[model samples]
Target: MSRIILLIAKFSAFMLFVAQVESNCPSKCDCNPYSWDMNQIDLDCHRAQLDTIPRNVPLTTAKADFSLNKLGLDPGFQLKLDHLHDLRNLDLSANFLESTHIKDIPDSVEILDLSANSLSELSLDDLPTNIRELNLAKNGIDSINGCSGESSIQSSSQIAIRFDYNAIPILTRDTFGNCSASFGYIDLSSNNLHTVEHNAFRGVIQKANDSLVIDMSYNKLEIVPFEAFQDAIFDMRGFEYFSLDLRKNPLLCSCNMSWIPMMLDYFQKMGLKGVIMGTCYGPEESAGRHLEELTKAEFKSCTEYSWLKAEIKARTEQRIMPFWQVCLVVLACPGLVATVVLIVGVRMHVKDYRRYRDYVVRKKRQIATQRRRHHFRASGAVGDVLLNSSIKNSQK
Candidate 1:
């Protein structure tokens, strides 16, 4: 009898534990009925008849899968998610959310799957600092602006930003301005972007280090601003693995596309490895031909408006001026005058030598006259000596 009583007490304790876990569910929603674990509770409110999100979700929950629900992100639903501080991953995909829902995302959330929504203009400030991966594919976002807030992403990590299949008309200047220097990978493909604004990615390239990779493919971009990439290549003191995929754009092959050939030639000579695929669209005749398939004449026709070719020709001509053509007149006049002067100087020297010879003959005749006067003086002295000797002989 006592053993039966002990068994009943153990069964009551187990039932109380299970009831306590079930009572911890958020108000007005069904938690996991099978498992009493709070973190692992799959709160699947898919297609639920509830109009507003339950505010009292478990704080320990990691994943909130809220897909295929008719939950419109009106003002009431936006207020409910304000208190979900522990949510790491939230999937609100396939829901027809308006632009206001993008503005209401909590900063604590990391991974948000808002793909297949009706978002037209998504501000970068709507993304939280902790967010590492975002899915805004198939949306109506035309441009990407950096988050403008005092609080920045604290995590020292790379965020994989994916924006695919959106009809972006233009990439605005300083698009990723508020991105931290630590961000690394970005994927922007299948958009309708026509012109990339100057300094569109200046901030991102300045902040990102060597591990950065940007994928921009399948856009309708006709012109890439050379100034936009000049700073990224020269000013930013970082090794960038920038791969530009400019394929499938209907490039206007008129004089406007002169920059294309110049950029291609520069990259080819420098051995730069990147995608440069496009077909000419304008100028009447070569409307639908790829750049690679065009002949030399077709390429030259495109160079009619090329400022680079004209500048190159001007520089080359300036470097090789003909030496004889420039100095011929200066040399001819002076050379003839110098030859006449040299001939006159040689003739004058010969005449001066003959005059010097005649002057030496006159000087020799004057010296002979002086020598004859000295000889007469010596003979008078000798005759005086002989008369004195004869007077001495007579005295003896």
Candidate 2:
């Protein structure tokens, strides 16, 4: 009988300890039992207007929703979540906080929602390896630290990332290169995207399966460089469930875009899914025209309007000279004539001078020859006189 009383006292103490732990839930937060086990709970403190993480959060919580709260970089704010060893989904979105606070988030979390925050960047360390869904939409991020597809975010077998409505201005080459994991969906829509370099989505397409879905609509894109998708298209050639949404973007249509028709044909032959053709909104002639409906004559052999204008200008130049050019030619005619006349006159004068010099030289040569002939005659006469004088003296 004494042993039974001791057992009852011990059970009462254990029950009291559990009751105290349950009562430690944060104030103004709803904590519901997650399972039949009273020790596991789910905390929902969303929009709680709390400036700091509640100190009384139970360590047994499996999912925490502190979204829409005033959680900033306050001291130990993330420490509060780190204590929940079993946390799976953490929603800290709409908090207007930077993502730096969650750089070292618990690896137990699989779904992390940092959307609608003030994050300007996301480093590889900011992502947990086991994460399956990472929502960073509606942030101020201009670029992801390691979006070349080798980052920790893509280390998982399957993950969905929402990066829409960010401040990304461009997608460079190999932005998603060499990724090996399959993504369910990747959203880069509604950003400030202006240029997507060739091979920008290479790594993304390399790892994606047939069920890949990508949204890139509602941006400032003028064109989608087909070279960027060339390899991706080949990789997804036989994929019947591939989908790429590029609607509502202001893509210009011109000769450079002649490959669109070819791309559509390839997609049809491969039985690829999703919207493969979009409407053009530029090149005035092709504007308000769908890529699918554009005939080869209508869309092909098409040049930019600026190029057409230049061609017309060139043709006109070949036909008629501009007023300025005509004036310049008219003004230069007299000068040309005068230059030719001056050159002719100078040549004639130089010819005359040379002729005169040759005449003077010939006259000097003639005079010198005449003087030599006279000297030769006088020397011959003197020699003859000397010979006769010697003969007469000998006779005397």
Query: How well does candidate 2 match the true structure, expressed as C-alpha RMSD?
Result: 24.9
Candidate 1 lDDT tens digits, 1-396: 999998898778657755654687655456553333343444565556545567666655556766666567554555256666666777777777766786566677788888887778777666776887788888887767665644366544667677888888878876776555344566677987777777776655544244455666677766565555545543333343445555576666655555555555544433443334567666668678765554434457654446555653454455545578669867787989999999999899889988998789767655654555465456787745654454354335
TM-score of 1: 0.56
Candidate 1 wrongly placed segments (more than 4 Å): 1-43, 47-50, 73-76, 149-151, 181-183, 206-208, 212-216, 233-240, 253-396
- Give candidate 2 misplaced runs (Cα > 4 Å): 1-22, 36-39, 73-80, 147-150, 153-157, 178-180, 205-208, 295-396
Per-residue lDDT tens digits of candidate 2, residues 19-106? 6655777888887766444456778899789888888788888788988877775545553566777887889898867767766678
Q: Which ten residues in a row have the lowest lDDT in candidate 2?
A: 303-312
Find the number of clashing residue pairs for candidate 2. 1
Using alpha carbons, what is the TM-score of model 2? 0.64
Best by lDDT: 2
Each model's lDDT comes to 0.63, 0.72
